[model samples]
Structures are given as C-alpha cells and as structure tokens.
Target: MNSTLPHLGFGTFRLEGQTAFDAVSMALNAGYRHIDTAQIYGNEQAVGDAIQASGVARADLFLTTKVWTEHLSRDAFIPSVKASLAKLSTEYVDLLLVHWPLNHNTVTMEDYLSSLKEAQDMGLARHIGVSNFTVAQTEQAVDILGKRVLLTNQFEVHPYLQNSKVVAKCRELDLIVTGYMPFAYGAVLKDPVIVTIAEKHGATAAQVVLAWMRQQGYVTIPSSTRQVNIDSNLKADSLELDATDLADIAALDRGHRVANPDFAPEWD
Candidate 1:
C-alpha cells in the first residue's frame, strides 16, 4: 500500500499447485509489479517459483504475504513469517499482514500486534498491517505498533460493499487503504450502471471499477488467471470517471459483503 507498491496488485487467494504457478507466471509476464500471496494460500512455493522464473529483479517487485491466524501465538508469530519468507524464497516481503484477526477472542490483540512489530524490527517484513480488521481493531493496531506506521488496512471495498466507515477511519489515521475484491467477485460486471459507464469510456466493466477505486486513492487487487484480463486491469489507471459516473457507482452500494466468516468480528 506504500507508494512503491503498485496501485493494482495480482492476488493469489485460492490459486494453488500448478494452477497457481501458471497464473502468477502469466501475471509477471503481463507486467504486474505487485504480487500478493499468504501463508495460508498454499502456493507461496509456486508463487516464489514464478517470481524466480520470470527473471524480474526482486528490487523491481513489491511482494506481500500474510501471517495466518494459526500462527499468531507469541512464540509462533515471527517463526511463521520466517517460514513464509522461506516458502516465498525471498529474504523479506514488502508488506506482511495478519490474515485474519483473532477477534473471536482466541488471542490478545496486543500480543499479535506486538509480534507483527517484531517481524519488522528483525527486517523480516519491510512493513506490517492487518486484514479483515474492524475500525476499532485498526485503531488498536496503531496503538500497539506505536510510532511504526500501520502501512495499510486491507478490506473488501467495491460499489456493492461500500465500507465508508472503515474507509474514513483509515484515512483519519493516515493509514493506506487496500481494497480487496475490488470487482465484487464479478458482481460489478453485471450491474447496469457499471455497464453504462463502461460503454461511455469504451472500457470493460472491470476497468470501470478499478479506475473508480484508484481515482478515490485506494489501492486495489483484482485477481485474474488470464493474461488478457491481467493486462487490461493494469490499464484501468488511465480510465477517467466523471462526477455523474462516480455518483451513479456510489448509488449502487447495497452493503453486500463477501468473505465473511462465522468467527469474524463485528463490521464497523
């Protein structure tokens, strides 16, 4: 989520095995500079393999990985990140996140946050942040990390799931907001408003959504397995949306959320 990180990133969520390798390899070839994966994604090895095979210098890429919830225990935290570095076959990741908060009360926020700081202190992670954390939890993370900048708060942000409360809270803290599921998992493509906007710009529906997010100053990661989609997504940064277009997209909010788990904390 830093300036050095690409505004659009290639996310490897469900991608695994050879499929993961092929997709990541294609993304790299298609000019993606930011690649996101997690310890729980079960494809860091494949991703790492792709990165190595791509022949792109590590310095030219922004890599991110998450510390799974199961590794949040004080003793296991740093070790898990180190293991993730190994799986990624890299010395360090540009950003590392707490995949999911132990908000169900399994672990103290202070403890896990402290562990995240520890990873950065040791240079295992260049930056640290949280994912799927509520606004209150994000505030607590800032407090725990102290002077260290909480680089980002990755959340679901799209026309359908417009999380204005979380967005405003993050900006108030001066923390970068990274929007995952920026396309609403293909739901945005079917919206008539989006279709109309796409027609006006001579762009695809996906391009309209990505452009809106970047124009609003939020970084987005919209995953795709196809080279054409990956290349097309990178160009969304060029599509300009007018005031009427933005308002229409804003009016499409229905509070629809994806990726909610039973153990998830209260949404802000």
Candidate 2:
C-alpha cells in the first residue's frame, strides 16, 4: 500500500501488443515509476510483462488499474479485479479506480463502491477512487464511502479543458486530482499560445503543457511510443512555470474534452 504517487506517470491507452511492451519498457528505462493502465486497455498483460522484464522491483513502482463498466456489479467486481491482478502479474495494485460511474439503471453506486472497498479490505488494492466522475458524483461517492479516503479522482484535465469545477471539488474533498490526456491527444501541441510559451521557455510544447499540469497541483499521465518523447516527458517534473506562464495557459481552456463517451456522466 504505497501512499506516495509520482506526479508524472506513463499512460498506456490505445497501446497494445509489442508496442505497449516497448513503450512501457522505455518509460521505465527513462525513470518513470508510475504506470497507468486499465482493464479496457486490453494490454494489462503486456504492461505486466514489461514490468516483470524491466526488473524494476515491484516495490519501487506504483501501478494503477481501473475496473471497467461491465464489471461494476457486486457479484462481478472482486473477481474482475483478481483477473486484472493476474494479468498485471502483481499481488496488489497501488491504486484501483472505477473506470466510470454506473448509470444506476443496472447497478447503484453503493454496490460498486462497496465492492471497491471490499477489494481494498482483501488486499487486492492499496487505495481506491473514481475516474470520469462529475462533481456531484464525486460528492456522492464521498458520502457513500463515509470515512474511507478516496486517494484521487482521475478525469480529463489539460490546457484546453481546465476542468476547474471538478478539480475544485476534489481539492475540497482532499483528494488528489489525476488528469489523463494531459496533451489532449496532441491537439494542444499546435496551439499558438502553447507554442509561444514553449519558445519563450526553450522547451517542447509537451513539456510546457506537462509543467502546467504539475504546477497546478494535478498529476498527469502522458504517453508516447517514441523513446525520445518518452524520455523527454519525464523531464517535465523539473520544468517550473511562473505566474505569467500559469495564467497564460489557464486562459487557453475552451471546455474541450477528449475522452467523452456516450456513457459519460453529466459533467460539473
């Protein structure tokens, strides 16, 4: 149950087969200890293989996996997590998340959330939280769990989608906000605002965006298949942004979201 989470993590989304394996291995080689994946990714085995092959002691790494929508039932939850653990080749994950809030037409929040806590009690997960959850849903989850601490509420947060409302709620609840799609799938890389800032700081557009995320007190998981990009992203940990830089990036928000599915909740 490692409580410490790396501010910058390596994301594994839309990555599969040997590509996922190679990218993860390169990230580990580049000194990334936090790895983010999900049951929906269909590459957990590949990620697990990369971890085992990296020889980075399991204790030295922080691994997170999310339980998918179909597995949210009380009867299916724990077994789904066990299946994930087997694929990850680990006894337990540092943090586990609900991939999406249930629609409540099929399963209620209490059923799934209780299942999450039960998994923690069984030592299948060190911590638990939610993903793609709205502000109201975040509060409901907190109330449902009572005193159980939610380590983080992971959702979309990038320069183009600041997601301030949900972020403020997570902060108020004392939960860490982990932002996925930090680069907005490379769309922000071409933004003139980000480009100008990158030139001023002599940094890459990716680094500038990542620095914005870290400086805002949010954790970001950015992924890349190229070794150079993977190695360079880790350096964002030390890239500092001044007040002007922060404010400039803050104004770039256009309420753009990249991960919206038909099943997504009504956002804050």
TM per model? 0.97, 0.98
Model 2: weakest 10-residue lDDT segment is 1-10
Count of clashes, each model: 0, 0
lDDT by residue (tens digit), candidate 2, 123-235: 99998989999999999999999744788999999999999999999888888999999989999999998999889888999999999988888888999999999988887
Per-candidate local distance difference test: 0.89, 0.92
Model 1 C-alpha lDDT per residue in residues 1-268, reported as the tens digit of each score = 3585578899988899998999999899988989999999899999999999999999999999999889999989998998888988899999999998885666799888888888998999888888988989888888877644778889999999989999998888887889999887899899999999999999999999999998888988889888899889888878999999999999999999988988788887
Off by over 4 Å in 1: none
In terms of lDDT, the best-performing candidate is: 2
For model 1, what is the alpha-carbon lDDT of residue 118? 85
